[model samples]
Target: MAKTVVITGGVSGMGLSASKLFLSKGWNVMIADFNKELGEKVYKELSSKYSKKQVAFQQTDVSNATSVTDLKTKTSQLFGKVDSVINNAGIFTKGALHEVAEDAWDRIMAIDVKSVYLMTKAFVPDMIEQKAGTIVNTASISGLTGDYNMAAYNAAKGALVNLVRAMALDYGKYGIRVNNINPGPTMTPMFKANPQSVIDTFKKASPLGKLAEPDDIARVMYFLASDESNPITGENIPVSAGFEIYSGQPVQK
Candidate 1:
């Protein structure tokens, strides 16, 4: 049977990379993203190279329940069924807790934490009915530990990690596996938004001596969603190139 996977934020960055990888693995991809422009472009680009039936694009606002509901409906109509879902939509907020605006914190929670809940609420039932499925959440190194000026991002991702654990506990009996992928300083648009000095410092400090590529994280996501990782559930797999080993050390850059 052909597998189907839905990836939120699938238009760019790791999400886009994962989308492509999923297709190459013989799974149909429903590219769900808030960026309509990128979404359509990816859909068209992939359609040009593969069977149109193997790919789709849906503009999704994962933070909004109504939007997610509609996304689920349309995705079902287009793909018939979904075998896995990657909650990869997220935003970055930088500032001390005391200085961060309340709105910024809420936005982070909505897109990062609440979006996971909404995706689960909307998709888990179908997965339960099928009795076999996987859910992959995109967390961050900030979730495992913390970074300066990232109070909102850290809190939201921390909640996301715990949520994966809770989901695994509740749904394991139904054969549904839930896991989190914690990426470190990947070269995504989000990271590129930072100044070059900031980027250089993080790259030099990483044990790998460079920021991770989107494909680096995408491969792990694919593995977790594949049968190869059937025994692994509720695991927080860090793909951060040893960022945790010396998170306390300052890069001399």
Candidate 2:
């Protein structure tokens, strides 16, 4: 029987790539995202490429505990049991620390951090019962370091890094693995949505001479989710293309 995997925010960006990779590897994929249109589109596209039984979608608002619970229930009903979960739903709230709105900070934290808690709570019981499972959280470089005009996003992602470690330590005895992937300046809808000048400036800052693509992060996720990384847990794997190692430098001309 094919292993079942659940991915939140699986309709776009790195989440979408992870979903496709798992499906290609013969895993049955259940993708959850807030955008019903994109969710349906991805499901249809994958279904056309693979069998309909190999792919599924559930409209989910990961920020809502009830919605996440419903997602888990529905996934179990369709796939019997989940073998892995990728907590990849997240958002960026752009604002400086002092000027950031209370509501914006709360909202970002709820989606980026609280969603992980809710998703883990909802799925870990089944994992414990089965005595095997993996959980991968999509954190960011901002989580490991500070960023300008990203107060809420930075804080939430930073919390996620530690949360992954704590989960790994607590659940290791149960045969459950928890880890985090921190990508730097990935080329995703969110990055493209930024002003062109801002994107250009960011690209020049990276030591690698360019921003990361979604596939760069997705490949790391695959390793963490697969048996190839079976002995690795409670770790933060930085997929930043050496951006983290670069010192302050003039923009590439």
Candidate 3:
């Protein structure tokens, strides 16, 4: 039987890129995102190329249990079983700890950190029963280190990284592998919001001398989701193009 994958926040950005890669590999894909317009748009685009039965979408608020439960049910109904899950749904916040408000902190944790818990709670049971599956969480380089003025985003991602580790340890015995993909500043909708100078600075800082494209990240995710990586678990792998070699290394004046 062909494989099936459930991708959260799969309507746009790196998630959308991952969706395309999985579909190209002949996998049934069920995408869940909060953006109804983008979700419908992606559904139409993919369904045009692949069978509608092989692609489905749900407008889901990942932070909500009800929405997550519905997503789980719909995915199972459409594809029968989920062999892989990409917990790529998240938001970024820019602010120092003192500057961020309680509401912003709550929202950051909800979408970035808590959603992982909710998703795992909803989906891992079947994987356990089947004794097989892969879970890939989108963490960040910032989670390992820290970025200026991004305390909330840093904290949430850091939590997600460790959560992947802890869960992998707990579930690996059941043939469920959990790992994290730590992407650097990628050229996604989220990073495109940066000013030209900011983008230039980041490009200069990167060892590759350019920001990553979404496919650059998706390809790594695809590998992790495949059986070739069955031996890998609890690994927080970085796809940062050597950004961590030393971020913002002195630029020529």
**Candidate maximizing TM-score:** 3
TM-score of each: 0.95, 0.94, 0.96
lDDT of 2 by residue, 1-253 (tens): 8999899999999999899899989999999999999899999999999988888999999999899999999998888999899999998888888888899888898999999999998999999999899999999888998887888889999999898889999999999999999999888887799999998888887767788888888888889988899899999999986777755666698
Candidate 1 residue lDDT tens string, 68-155: 9999998899888789999999998889999999898889899999999999999999999989899999998889997888888999
Q: How well is each residue in 26-52 modelled by candidate 3, as lDDT tens digits?
A: 999999999999899999999999989
Candidate 3: 10-residue stretch with minimal lDDT: 243-252
Model 2 TM-score, 2 decimals:
0.94
Clash counts for all predictions: 0, 0, 0
RMSD of each: 2.3, 2.4, 2.0
Candidate 1 or 3, higher lDDT?
A: 3
Ranking by TM-score: 3, 1, 2
- The better candidate by lDDT, 1 or 2, is 1
